[model samples]
Target: MEARERVVKMGALKHHSIVRRILTLVVSMVILIALVNSAVINTMIYRQLLTEYKSKGIAISQSIADSASDILLFRDPATIQSLLDQHLTINGVAYLVLEDAENNIVAHTFVPQVPQALRTIYAGKRTTTATTAFHRLPGLGNVYEISQPILFGEIGIIHVGMSLKPIHHSMLKVVAILIPILLVVLITALFVFRSRLRFVTRPLVELADYTKHLAGHNFEQSLPEQGAIRAIAAEHNDEVGRLSETIVSLEDAIMTYIGDLKRTTAAKQKIESELMIARQIQLGMLPKSTDNTAFETVKIASYLEPAREVGGDFFDFINVGEDVYIVAGDVSGKGVSAAIFMATTMMLIKAKAQEHIPPQELMVSVNNQLIALNENMLFVTVFCGKINRYTGIFSYVNAGHPAPFIKRKNEALEIPLTGGMALGVDYHHYYQQRELQLENNDTICLYTDGISEAMDVAQNQYTEARLAQCIGQSKAVSAHELMDDILQDVRIFSDGADQSDDITVLLASWCHASASVSSELGVHFTNDLSEIAKLHQVVDIYSQANGLTKTLQHNLKLVLEELIANTISYGYRDHEIHDIKVFFTVVNNALNMRIEDDGIPFNPLEDAPEVDHSLSLEDMPVGGLGIHIVKNFVDTIHYERQDHLNVVEFTKSLGETA
Candidate 1:
């Protein structure tokens, strides 16, 4: 009985194999015929519909042009509307419009307004004959538009649009009917022939099940091969047989790959851990928060954010005697390589800064050192400056960096770029030095391109112009507050965009110590004699608040009035108005005053005449009396011509206010 059952099974498989091939051939031919028939039918119907619609549109437009000529001459919109309505009722007529030669619509058969796309038909050059083209209206779908010029477009024009939506509907209907027929034939063929072929497919199913089982494990050893899968792999040499053999081999390959992956993952994790430690170490290399006690009158604030685990922007401050060296630099590129280059540049800067050399000389030294060590050809843009904390003189050098901003009073001005190249590019490149005079409460802002070139989602940058405006608005605030506000503004402009580069900002403010609660006062006025009274009022108020004696107040008022009167009277060569600025600071029972004016250069110490005791007041020259009084009232005075302005500074030691 068992032998008989085996014979029957083999015979059934043989019969079904023949049936499968015949059914497959019949199904392939049916699908190919259906596809070819649908494509050919759709193309023929679309072309026929387009040609018919275009012809109908052109015929209607020409008829309207013939009938509307009288209406165009009479300028009768009602008759033109009647003519358009008559033609719009025709089949597939989407819209009809009548317009004079000026392209102004006189009549349109539309529920609302005609589509603006139709206007271009006549809006172009005048069409002597009937012209036709295709267009897609907003609500009307595809359309065949035709235009006819009446009396060579001098009198008027007629437009007609025929809808092409019917062609699309016909094509869809053909596909819908043919697809179901193809599916029915395929289903019948599969059910009749494929159902009997399960005898041949059972072995394949067993191989698939064995493969899935093998995939679920780490494959500590080769899986026990199933009998059915072994039979297919060994007994037959067809596609199924080859697939079974490949799966058996794949089990061993997967086990080897898993071991390698585990080792690679562990190694990657160790590398990441090391990188994290390196990031912390790199951060520790940066200078700490400045101790206010160390930098007596100068307030410094800095902010740094890296685009990755490490970045390339750095800033440093080093004090040497009475001067402080400020450095801000950016190494090209980003990530670990840039961070290493940045670290190198920073170390070189510190080494050179210890020498207390001028900014330009220091830059030259650092540039040469970096070039020697630069194997990757990396470069850095640096801005280095030295500021005399007491004298308020800042000498700076730019090395292909963005110009820093100076916030004096309520204005933010960008220092002009000095012609220099970035470091490590060329050893012989010479750097130029520039100087600025910082007064009380003035701020210097240093930054990298990250802040200025920060981009929003739409790629708009936080430009330098906007940065200047922000600084100007945040004027008079402390360095810490200003830095916070600037960072906040940058955040708002970026609007959650991913940061692409490192960001660093440094703000240094000059806030000289003063005895009074109000540290300093700066006043601006034109060169007018009447401005003296305002000066007196200011001097009196300030001196009184600071507990100055009546004698000291009188002397202060007298000295300022004398110097200002001399300047307003003789400093100008023309009657045009000129501005004068005065700044006052009091510290330890002493008054410091600085006067600046853009007038003819005059140094009171050199230009003033000598007052000799032998010469009477009447014998003395007229110009020297006022200056001699000023010189006597102030204990120490200095004058210089800088930036085309006369700068006169004086300090008076008022002995304890009694």
Candidate 2:
């Protein structure tokens, strides 16, 4: 702890005072080196001064010795003394002395004698060779003296003293002048280096404080503005400046991230609340799993589970009129929006189914409603069917959803769910209804894509083939057991992976109670007279297959022709296309013919005139002949008005003769 405190304190102090020490060390060392170099230069200059003065002194002494050599050899001192006197007054020449080989002074340049500081220097070297030496002259600060043997003389010694007055004194004067100036310059440099310290340390100190705030998670702290620190950072292209800029950038990122986090958190809460409510509403819209709503001859089982809190998958079964409608579908999204679309779609299906609407027309109307209301471009794929409880005929329309699987005791496979795009694509789109006559113990399995697309941890799908195979194994089971087993298999296939979509499955089993079988063949025709030949062809085929005689076939053809001709003539008022449907069915060897027309409402069974046998042929009504003949060919005739259209049904027993 102590060590750490020291380090922290050092770091804090380093922000302010670190550069001062560096500059002090560098500037102090530079000033000290300058002073040392000046001293060294002064010494070299003094030495050079001494050497020049000594050389001049030696030359003067040699001139004196050369002049005295000839005179002293002849004992002529008078001329030597005159030469000495002439050179004595020259600068830095303290003395000039010449002696004979007998030790007798011949000439001297000094006025009296050697100075006290120069006496020992003059006597220091007595060799015959020349030599120079420095000595302290009493009045002069320093001097150099040289002694030489005059080579021009026979046997004479010369001694010269050169005072180092001007050169040495000038060098000393320079040292005295430079020491104070150098002290002033060093002080000024220290002040300048100290004042510039803020430029380098201010950013570092600001960054230190900023980092401390960040370390404490104090996100609310305001950073330095465009003040001194910022300006310094901008001006100075250094490590401290770059670090400060980076800190400012980090602060902006953190601020932005915090704002986004708050918004995201609030949005998440709102969505979760809405999803909770929507989930309840969506689940409530479906039929309860405990409520197995089915007729005695038909058993039903369904399951719906959402991947999200609310899902787009839904299934419903409603009893409308004499038929039961089962709807299984999926909308194109997830969560709240998808759940809303699913609920809307289901409600529409139920409303139309209650009116005994056929699946094709029901799909078209539902699609148009969705398209009109869908501002979000939402769509649904639905498989809705109407099951005739008494006859076990399943009529359904596939509106871009997955096709239902028809599993009997013998076969299991998927049929194509063709016709019509997904809802909300186009209001004018057409959907076709298909009919599947269910035998005993036949199961219709309707589902959404969730079943086949259920994935494993490895992302392998539980495909349609696998679903079919699983259902095939459970073909003999009850509807509830079959659905349970299939769901369990799906769970196994998932391998603990989370569901990615809404899984919905509806199983409806149908078994006809009666032993006799029924079959229907239908024919569609336009208003053209040429199409009547196709009606005739249907009549002959049904007649031969059901063991009807040729006469009965002819009579049936005539009855159909009269009904179709009446519909084509009077049913539609405008010049437009119309569909007239004729159904021929054999039930327990009884021929049942049902004709439907999308035309003006007219009950032919009630409006046909009773033939008047008492009148002559010319007095009878023309239209009564065809109706009268049709009334006699069949045992019973029935008529009903539905949807502004007409339905005519007739039945004939197999044992009846023509």
Best by lDDT: 1
lDDT of 1 by residue, 1-658 (tens): 5754555566556555666676778678878887888889888988887888777787888778877887789978787888888888898888887778877888888778776666664575576777787888788888777888898888877878888877788779978987998789778867765764564465565675576567566666666664557678886677878887777667768878878888898899998888788788788888776423135457788888888888899998887656788889999998888999999999999888888899999999899999999999999999999887666788999999999998887788897788889999998789899888888887889999999999999999999999999998884477777888889999999999998778899888875544222637887768999789767766765676677778878988998998899899999999999999989897676789899999999897888876887977678666578888888888889999999999999988878662
Query: TM-scores of the models, in the given order?
Result: 0.44, 0.49
TM-score of 2: 0.49
RMSD of 1: 37.0
Give me the displacement of residue 17 in model 2, in angstroms. 3.9
**Residue pairs of candidate 1 with colliding backbone atoms:** none
Error of 1 at 520 (Å): 20
RMSD of each: 37.0, 20.6
Which pairs of residues collide in model 2?
none
